[model samples]
Target: MQSTYTEGLNPEQKKAVLHHDGPLLILAGAGSGKTRVLTHRIAHLVEEKGVAPWQILAITFTNKAAKEMRDRLERMVGARVHDMWVSTFHASCVRMLRSHIEKLGMGYHSNFVIFDSADQQTVVKSCVKELRLSDANFPPRGVLSVISNAKNEMLTSDRFQSLNAADYRLSKIADIYTRYQRILVQSNALDFDDILMLTVQLFEKHPDVLTSYQDKFRYILVDEYQDTNNVQYLLVSQLAKRYRNICVVGDDDQSIYKFRGADIRNILDFEKDFKDAVVIKLEENYRSTQHILEAANQVIKNNRGRKGKTLFTQKTSENKVTLLAAGDEHEEARMVAEHILWLKSTTDYAFKDFTILYRTNAQSRVFEDVFLRQAVPYRIYGGLRFYERKEIKDIMAYLRLV
Candidate 1:
């Protein structure tokens, strides 16, 4: 509704901006103005369409994106944007559950905790010892993945036993899952899956609370819809029933998380779920060149069962996505080192501006040694993030108690 705001945007982006309606799906390609459209739509709704800022739910994939979107929308519509329900799916679900966790016998300020994959692995290792499962037979890592998969599919221990009792291995995995869940519940903690699963349970069981939120948040927007698993999809389904102003934006080609229980079925069944839905394809490439676009198109063309869109690019040339093979890791390191030296000396590339990724953490040791030899300053962003670990905090607390 902000006429002047749409004046600067191109026709496609303008259409997206004006489309402030029911169950919109914006299929954004890489480097497309998806963020721009998202921001403008939010701004337009708040600024001109008289949609109260609190009623709009703008979700993103990452906390960083959520922050950026909130900041950008705040810039457009002033401090009122603070009232908007803008967060990642995990964050949003946690907040929703926090408000009503007591209904499930959790404390009001229960201080529910989350364990990272590594922490969960630690729990699994302890369980392996307790159960006396031989390392030769049951690897902790493999069992952990099995349990994670079961949780992702929203399978409770009883449900899994009833359904998958024929498989002995599956029974063992469910045994581990049941124990892991018990430890979590006993500790008054909730992991990422608990956030989604519990929210679904709360909504299904507590109709009054669901109705309150449904009436409170008039519009719900979900980003990265394809990544949603059973629990996440169920959460969306419950909310969408009442509000019906739900917009899900995602790319099927970008769905790379099948291993972790992300059901591409949610995207496939979008039309079936939402009877009256608007599907919009954003195919204009604003970042990549024609060559890159063509190569991507050719690769994705091999995939089956997709409502494909033709990606066209008016953009000019850029550096190519090089494909290379190395006989050994040493050869790979030497090639990488040479490239780094050339980039720093010949080209105007900074070490800070560049990133080098390897398949495994072990692979990074060679790169680190090579970079150190070349006197290239670099740091790997992994492992324990500050302020969260129990060992680190407990040490500090002991020192304080001393």
Candidate 2:
């Protein structure tokens, strides 16, 4: 078949685009054309492989990324691409579960709401209030965190009891988890964990349903594949056990979501999971200067147990990294603000060009306060994501109804 993606890409990228055999893992470095490769791969699947749009599943990490991929696919194949599965992990799972909720004893056209951290805390607070637990002794947030952990690991109340240690707090949290799931089910709701776990259960019990979906989807592509949790891994594994035509793209060095139950083992054991997996490294970076890529590569080299590869950029510009030491916290903020102000005033740099990154979202508060005091135009990124927005939730609820 003739190729549609070879028009703009160079020879190396064209090679990656054309190679469509077995389970492919594109180990893309930062600032690499990972999105370009993914979109081109989808286009190649349709145009070259003759795969229908409904037979493709493109899983992304964030709603923004999913939206971008959907937009790109739409541009590639126009309106026909809208029928394909392209969304975040949670969003896609929710859609899948909602379609076959009856197999898992869940009601169809039900209100299966997904609660974020704050929403879960609210539920926990209500549970604590009903249980008459002391807030001083047992914080709702702490209880919710424990419950969330258990759910992320796909542990049921019975399983939790079997493995429950002698810790009174853990026991109490398990009891709360059982109660929480019961409440969620009664309210016709399912949190993020329930989405995948329920779908897996449905697939296991209902053979015909599973076969129908398995026959429908011919190719599955997952982005940020290293960040898949246990439930997500299980869901993908079950779906691909029949066809085994799955392609996962990710960088092992950039797997930074362990705290939220993301198992890096998924990436490490890709060969064991999928026999004779084809590993392709896209080491040619398109973003950033050569010097910046060197610094990033050096910093990431400190991380051990990674699929080793050196990233190089074709751009020859030299961008040097700057280090500053300040005596106090306030002084550090003041220094950064002054530096940004100086850059904005002297150079053609705009206020939007500069960003302050920190380890935790809490660290952004001091900089935000300092920037406000200095009357600088800056935006702090934190809190609920775009998919967690009220409008998006409402729209999803409506779609779930339909």
Give the winner by lDDT: 2
Residue 316's C-alpha lDDT in candidate 2?
Answer: 89
lDDT of 2 by residue, 151-215 (tens): 67778876886678577777777777777777777777777677777777778889888888888
Report the C-alpha lDDT of model 1 over 277-343, residue by residue, as the tens digit. 8887888888879889988998898989876877878877777767668888877887888888788
Query: How far out, in Å, is residue 65 in model 1?
Result: 1.5
TM-score, cand. 1 vs. native:
0.82
| Candidate 2 regions with alpha-carbon error over 4 angstroms | 106-119, 341-346, 350-352, 368-377, 381-402
RMSD score of candidate 1 (Å): 6.4
Local distance difference test, per candidate?
Answer: 0.79, 0.80
* Count of clashing residue pairs in every prediction: 0, 0
Pairs of residues at least 3 apart in sequence or in different chains that clash in candidate 2: none
Off by over 4 Å in 1: 105-111, 116-119, 318-402
| Highest TM-score scorer | 2
| C-alpha root-mean-square deviation, each candidate | 6.4, 7.8
